[model samples]
Target: MSKIKIMKKFNFIIQSKGGAGKSFFTYLLGIKHEQNKETLFIDVDGSTSTSTNQLKFLEDQKRIGVIDLLDSQDRIARDRLFGSIEEIAELSYSNYILDFGAPESEQLPALFSRDVNQQELKGFAEFLNSEFIFHVIIAGGTAYGACMQYLTDIVRVVGEEFKIVVWMNENTLLNYPKQVEQILEAANALGLDVERFGDVLSGSVFDTKLSTIIQQGLGKAGIMKSGYMIQTQMKKLTAEIII
Candidate 1:
């Protein structure tokens, strides 16, 4: 294997609410990291595996991997997840971006609520010499309440050891301006970093076209190839990401 680059951070895109743009955000972050570092994209979505699907090209190149936590009985297999973590710990250098599905998202925070799991994760981060940053989504519209609750739950469980980054989706921001403001205030009070997306990702004609390309498993290269308008939007969206 090629020498892995020293990882700076292990980023996780997590949100319990579906349609909150977790996979899209993960893809953007993966592309950003891929530009400069040896990065691994892990899709832990047992159900849809949308991130895995979108990043299939990268997986074929061995830059992406999948670890479905659900067992044959359709339950979250904790032991299997820990085993995967051990394998990743052995590769302590390359940066990892994990896009978690709704069920796995909830389970991870819950796991962090336990002291033993928290210590284990802290040890893993220490061994890798990387900071753990959870990129949680706080969207608007009908998902606002659930998203906010999930954020609070994560904060409550992860404690002060791990860093939390909030990604505010702009698609429904106008519809729930007050709620968005509340989230901003809370994030500010908590001193968590906030990133805004969806200006270009808002379901426009070009955005729809871009989404279809991504879903077709062409990844970033496809976006770059599909005309200038989509490429421009993809660039703009990726530019706004601070992770």
Candidate 2:
């Protein structure tokens, strides 16, 4: 068993409107934390729209996404799920991504319904408390404001320290083609310390190709506003901040 990397800095929450790239960005962030192995991803989207193609593509990349774990009723299964989350906190290898996407027709109603305190509900909450789960919300243009309010209410009930990420990742294969700058600028005004990254799915770079793109982009000025750029900035910026 690998030692899990317990997150030192609370949890990250990416909350946005429906089409704000929450689903894809969640996977990307989870991938970044893979080496920590203690990372967990809770889908909660229950979206059937892009499940077929997107998730399928992610699986092909050998990512440890958790959508397949939705049908376990065994106590051992629950135990495995719970233990895996905590176990990954100090480990190396990103096998700890948990997909919380339930069937939309089934679990989507729960989000709208008032508190039920069901057993499963309690278990899920327990899972979150034990695991420093990051909440990534998809904030589409029309759905942004309402989702923030809705998420605020939900997180209040859950009592988790989720860092809201307002993603402005474009879906086209150009990464940060000229138009994203304005969108990212607006996102920065939200007071959430927004982080924007290239929509890996929509970008032309893959694996080594992506690495080169990041290397070139990081050192530049104008084209460096993307999420990857911010991560680089965070490293340098935090180096002397000394928490």
Candidate 3:
């Protein structure tokens, strides 16, 4: 008999520059995962409250775990926030979709900073890798140029151990495919081997029935028309995502 693959998937949806659809994409991925796999969501963007609200539907379903890192500028708050991540990473066997928000957005990069203990962070990465196929998925909005900068910064800090996935989130006036081309050109200019990077997964959730409903903070209709739209887009996006 053939053995089954049981690799846990940990997707940290990130972008230092805000309004890049981090929360939106996180919710989509979480909903998709809940169809089968055990999933957990950590909303670190307490300021925006977008993902926190959009995810309420799932929370009510009692199908997944959700944590909100409190919004604060205090150093202690940052510590507790980072501590929660470590705590969940240690205890959970389910797949994780961590939606990072403001302030503490720098925590992941700080772990690999020269000022911190790189050795310890590296060991933690190893532990996570042992249990999960850890990947960092970045969502870039219409400001494609700024998104490229964030990508490079993360690539520099995290090193090459983790797979980096680029998501072209269409929110601006710029063309989606063009932005993707520019991102690749930028990555090549930075000496990153494009082959190792996961394929660019692009989509837009704006003006959709689901988005409109969520924006209005209305009650769930149960089996919504917009849900089908989201699932269709997510199916394509997830298919492109190399696990």
Candidate 4:
């Protein structure tokens, strides 16, 4: 495998709410960095395995490793999971996008909140900050309130070391044209630095022409067009991402 070019860059496509396009965006982020830099797309969402499927091509080609977190079961599985996480922390010198499963995200804060054993997770975050620039990708939708709360939960757990990027996934404009305002309000209330977050992006994957063309069997040509459309969307989103 090629060495990662950016050492301190970590992107976690996180959202407690499902159907928010986390996996799709994860695939796009991987594509954005795959060609020019060392990129590792870790699929931690074992339930849906959406990212795992989307990035299967990369895994098959040996360009990425899609880890199905659901596969981590039993004591042995948990041990392996811990080992893998530690190994990544130790050996990761490339850009990484961890598609955190909803169950894991929901459990993480609680797991890390305990007084006695929280040091492990805190240490993990510290290792990330010391070794890589950490980032959180918040996927939001019509449920704007839930989105804000999710962001708050993440910030509370991870602290202020990481930059946040919010994706307006569903009914983006129709639901909240002034979504940024809502975010700002929430940030102010929570005492989070608004400057620490990046601009929001429209992350809708279903409204594209590709989704329509696929039903008509437009084949490779339609697929190519959809790919271009997705690329354009990803370019805009990544451009505003805080390093």
Candidate 5:
């Protein structure tokens, strides 16, 4: 741990609907990064349950993996949640990527609830502010436009400082113009800090044998060519961050 560098902790402010590759992205993170026991994934998204099941089912056997960290909505009440998030920053780890619940995901409840008052929002914001890594990821589809607007509004009340990252998730398909535009429009409406917004790590990052499993699950085959494909824009962005 003494040999590792301590940088600001970051949370991936992630948003999306089911089947938009959130878990797939996390699986890739698992594939490439070193796993430290000190690290913790604060899964506000219940996707962890199903995603973990998928991972296990793929092996056709029992599996002991971090994917099981996903908690139910009822478990969100734990005080240790914030402590775990803080530890992710303080402990030795290269990065902490949090995959938040999708707007339509029923398992993970809403954050900006009418039932939950401002006091709760402030507490949540304070916890996130204290986190060494704080970030956000926006879903790219035009369908998710309203949801993005909702997140911007939520972050505004919570505080606009979360490290927001927009994932364009570009592929050959679609009547899509630009995913970035959707992200910008929503952020602009809520007056978020977007001067230096992060780049979309194109879907190509999911290139591995595990990715093949994902494609097969989706009833597709060999979606992305084999090889390492880095998101150049994000690589440069991260390099700027490193120095």
Candidate 6:
């Protein structure tokens, strides 16, 4: 039998609005990739180190390494960000997951639009022999419009060679099913891949309970250990995502 090909790719989770579940999705993706590959988790979100904190459990295992691009003022050092990308490009053997803060949604797309940055990103993809996929989360309720606009902006900047994945957050889906449908339609119209994330149970008692676990730094594993229901939900959600 012919050997099945293992696809290698870099996944970037970026969104303009805070509380849109960027870190949560990154955590889920990390769990999905942990078993089979040596993955590098880059926490570019200077404003909040949620992803980095969540993945701390892997540090002892040497499964991941982090690059802190933030200065004392909690701002991203542009030069350092560029330099780090170059450095990471050299480590072509491992997969990468980059979690960008809300502000970076604007900055990164602008950077990617530049001819120089575009060439660098394309070169990295080639050098690493991997595909680059941008994961944008579109949540329901008040954040929906801003999230969709961010998605549009990303589509405008990124070239056709790159793939875009739209993740629909289920927390507010019940309250905004029509909006969810609209976003799905828009994503389909743009030829982007779409997936539904399990409900995070935000703004509820259960969410409050989960928050306590998260604050303790156990991250996704904490949630998984919480109960079988959450585990099943997470499994279903992550299973649909193609690395």
* Ten contiguous residues with the weakest lDDT in model 3: 193-202
Q: Cα lDDT of all candidates, in order?
A: 0.77, 0.39, 0.54, 0.53, 0.42, 0.73
lDDT of 1 by residue, 171-229 (tens): 76767779878988999998888879867636679878967877787767777788888
Question: What's the TM for model 1?
Answer: 0.87
Clash pairs (backbone) in predicted model 6: none
Superior by lDDT: candidate 1 or candidate 2: 1
Q: How high is each candidate's TM-score?
A: 0.87, 0.41, 0.69, 0.68, 0.52, 0.82
In candidate 4, the residue pairs with backbone N, CA or C atoms under 3 Å apart (3 or more residues apart, or in different chains) clash, namely: 4-94, 8-132, 8-133
lDDT (tens digit, per residue) of candidate 2 on 1-243:
996543233233334344454444443443344334343343333344332233332333344333332334411233443454445443443334333442322232243234333345445545544333344443434554554454444444443333344434433314334444543554455434444454444333343443443333222232244457445643442232111
Write one digit per residue (lDDT tens) for candidate 5, span 98-142: 555564232223433433444664456465444422233344564
How far in Å is the alpha carbon of 82 misplaced in model 3? 5.3
lDDT of 6 by residue, 1-243 (tens): 996445466778889888888877777676676565467788876666777787776666565666776557655555776577668766744577888888766566666665335557666667656678888988888988889998998888775668889988887666897997898799879998888774766677666765565456464567677898666765776786666
Query: What is the C-alpha lDDT profile of model 4 across 1-243, one tens digit per residue?
Result: 996444345566677666555655564465555454466677777676666666544654455555544343411144444566666655545666687777655555544354213345445656555342324343335556665677777677665544555454533434555776776676667555542222234344534543343234232333456677644544565554333
> Candidate 6 — what's its lDDT?
0.73
The per-residue C-alpha lDDT of model 1 at residue 34 equals 56
Highest lDDT: give the candidate number.
1
Model 2 spans with C-alpha error above 4 angstroms: 1-17, 30-63, 68-95, 99-129, 138-140, 160-243
List the candidate numbers ranked by TM-score, top first: 1, 6, 3, 4, 5, 2
TM-score: the better of candidates 1 and 4: 1
Task: Give per-residue lDDT, candidate 4, residue 197.
Answer: 24
Alpha carbon RMSD to native, model 1: 3.1
